[model samples]
Target chain A: MIFDLVIYVLIGIGLFFNILAGIGLLRFPDVYTRLHAGTKCTTFGSIFLIGSVILLGLKMWWEKDTNGSVLALHSALALVAILLTNPVGAHAIARAAHRSGIKPAQAVIDELSEEPMNVTTDERRGGD
Target chain B: MIDVYSTYLIVVIALSFCVILAIVRVLRGPTAPDRVVGVDTINTIVIVSMVAFGTAFREIIYIDVAIVYALLSFISTLFIAKYLQGGEF
Candidate 1:
């Protein structure tokens, strides 16, 4: 009983934040701001949502259901895939946006306005 | 009695709220990149929701779809990034 309650709560919380992320994405003023809203909110929401699935899977597995184990394991893998790819993809998008000369709206100043900083920086200078 | 399916319904409704909000962003975003960001965020949210829906419906197929969606979105993001960079392949 308690376990089911916990899972329900987790799913509810996850869904709540996912909605907030979508709202933030819409309401933010500029590209950078939108990126901030979209990326962080979605990431946070995904954590809870995936966590709920994991809990559900665990609960099912505990009940000795074969299908439950599969659900839990596959969902975990999907979560891992999301975790690994989402941030990197966001970073790449931000970098590309910066590179393409897409400036933030209503910006005061761009401190890192130099061209291809990622390319010219010594740390990124190793492509064969 | 708050059955399991009802819980799933509530989650779906909540997630729809999010999707609406993202749509607003997509529509209102001033620049292309801003729109892209909104789209990217939507992609992530959708994947999670797909998983939720799969769990709700007790079908493994939705999870499979989510996995495929994740990979495809990743590719799309990379392609968009490359386009933004405006360089040769």
Candidate 2:
């Protein structure tokens, strides 16, 4: 009884955050902000969603089902993949955007732009 | 025992709706980076949806596929970012 409720709550939270990410992507003014919504919210939401799956796997294992261990283990592996890759991908995208000359929209203070990082790139292409 | 399969199905459907929203951003984005962001978001959501589907259907293989998809998407995102920066790969 209680287990089902917990799973429901996790799913609800995950679904809410995932939807928020989509909304944020559409509503945000600039690329950086959109990346903020796209990357962080989805990553967080995936955690909860996969976490619920992990819970279900545990429940199954508790019931003495043979497939339960496989389910829980594989789900954990997937969750780990999400946790490890999402942030690094976000950072890479943000860095590339800044390097490519896409400025933040309506910014109050710009620190990275001020202290120009000496990133070596092909000079012929020019900053796009 | 309460059945949560329907809940998982609903979650998958809702996530597909979210994918549509991201697709809008991709279509309407002003810049290349914006489109890339939309694609990245879609990838993440799809990964979660796959896992949910696996749970809903009581299949373990779908979860394995999700894991593989997550890794591949990460690679693609990195390559795209590198290409955007115009740096030598």
Listed in order, each prediction's TM-score against the native is: 0.88, 0.92
Q: Is the docking of candidate 2 incorrect, acceptable, medium or high quality?
A: medium
Backbone collision count in every prediction?
1, 0
DockQ in order: 0.73, 0.78
Per-residue lDDT of model 2, residues B1-89, tens digit only: 54887789989999999999999999999999999999999999999999999999999999999999999999999999999999789
Q: Write the residue-wise lDDT of candidate 1 on A1-60 in tens digits.
A: 887788778786777678777767766777787777787877877888788888887878
Least lDDT summed over 10 consecutive residues: which range in candidate 1 chain B? B3-12
Q: Return the clash pairs for model 2, or none.
A: none
The sequence of per-residue lDDT tens digits that candidate 1 reaches over residues B1-89 is 88664576667677877887887777877677877887888789789878888888889889989988999999999898888788896
- Candidate with best lDDT: 2
* Candidate 2 displacement at residue B63 in angstroms: 0.6
TM-scores of chain A, one for each prediction: 0.82, 0.87
Worst lDDT run of 10 residues, candidate 2 chain B, spans B1-10
Q: Which residue segments of model 2 deviate by more than 4 Å?
A: A116-128
lDDT of 1 at B14: 78
Q: In candidate 2, what fraction of native interface contacts survive?
A: 0.86
